[model samples]
Target: MSNKIKEREIQIERLQNNLSPIRKIAGWTAEVLGDKIGVTKQTISNLENKKTPMNFTQYIAIRSVLDYEISNNKENEVLPKVVALLLDCDDELDEADYSKVQDVVGTVAATAAGGTSTDKLDTVFDVLIKTLPFVVPIIGTIIGTSANWSKKLFK
Candidate 1:
């Protein structure tokens, strides 16, 4: 390969390597990309290795699909936890999981590009889910609201 091709190959490797979350969460690999885009596994390997250049659309599709998969996994992971919490599971969620549940949902929904009614609904639903947590980081709001409500109730 020429110097430019070699450099691009390195870049592809770096990009794929950086997608740790995708691999860890959703098991995405170049082979997965090839399936999604109708390319051969070899072509995906070449693109990812920077042996061949990828077009902007292909890059975007890779990112979009990979992120969608990862984020969907994250959202799915949270649901059982949240439901378990509602059922009074012994384990409490960490702050990060609480925060990330909405984030992952939002990212996946937003990437849908209005393709379906379900997609639009998901985007709206994710927005709402993500908004549900603004109260958590505010430590005193609930306490204060309770106090005020108590005062009114007693008065």
Candidate 2:
């Protein structure tokens, strides 16, 4: 093998070492991710196990698929946490407002579970629009209180 090919193989080996863990973190099985990347599950297994040398095309496709999966996972994870924090920080939500928030959360969670990234965002935005009457007040109160505190400190 040429020096360049040898270096490429080493790089592939290094990537293979971390691939399985990262894929698991993204909540994807080899078969699912392989389907998304247009590869066979056996091919994915081979790459992860370092039984087959991954070519440049496979590397690019796998990297792209993984990046997309990781991004979607981050979004799905963060959205609910943020919503929870916002709800927790607010002390004055009445029964009706709480119900609205719960509805929004349920919709967002359900969409995240099965929808594409765009679909998830669309669902979230739709829920936000529907709940804006109450949500805006909560958000405004949070922001206004923070601004007041900042002004008092500066003064």
Candidate 3:
């Protein structure tokens, strides 16, 4: 209500948002974290702002609740639900979707340039390896160096 209180609330919200897994793992801020732990929204706010620490027992209780929920709903539930939204969206992927597939160009073009039919299909596979990072957005950077091998050989 007071200006200081409002500022703290905003800062707390930002802190929660900045957490990498707060959205992915917790399904957003102050969610089941509060409902299951018997902690109030205000208490969660204070935790996020570092005004107070999460008691060891409270952390155990809260984490157990979230872990149970996320683990039970992990792949079959969460992945499918997320995929459903992308699949059901009204906007169909345009040429932009192919952009993720762009790393294919050099390999395919090289194959074409070489004018070789022997192992020509390897281009598709090679390109797929190269394009895989861009295609798999989840851990793109992890596989980033993997693609560089192709650039070394090709270019």
**Which has the greatest lDDT?**
2
Query: Of the pair 1 and 2, which is ahead by lDDT?
Result: 2
lDDT of each: 0.43, 0.53, 0.40
Give the better candidate number (1 or 3) by lDDT. 1
| Tens-place lDDT digits, model 1, residues 4-79 | 5554444344344333233222334556667986777787777645677666456446545653553465543322
- TM-scores for every predicted model: 0.34, 0.42, 0.34
Worst 10 residues of 1 by lDDT: 81-90
lDDT of 3 by residue, 12-62 (tens): 343333222232323434654577778776787777666775454554454
What is the lDDT for 35 in model 3? 70
All candidates: CA RMSD in angstroms?
A: 17.7, 16.3, 18.7
Ordered list by TM-score, greatest first: 2, 3, 1
lDDT minimum window of 10 residues, candidate 2: 146-155
Model 3's alpha-carbon lDDT is 0.40
Q: How do the candidates rank by lDDT, highest first?
A: 2, 1, 3
- Name the better of 2 and 3 by TM-score: 2
Model 2 misplacement above 4 A: 1-8, 75-155
Candidate 2 local Cα displacement, residue 97, angstroms: 50
Q: Residue 100's C-alpha lDDT in candidate 3?
A: 37
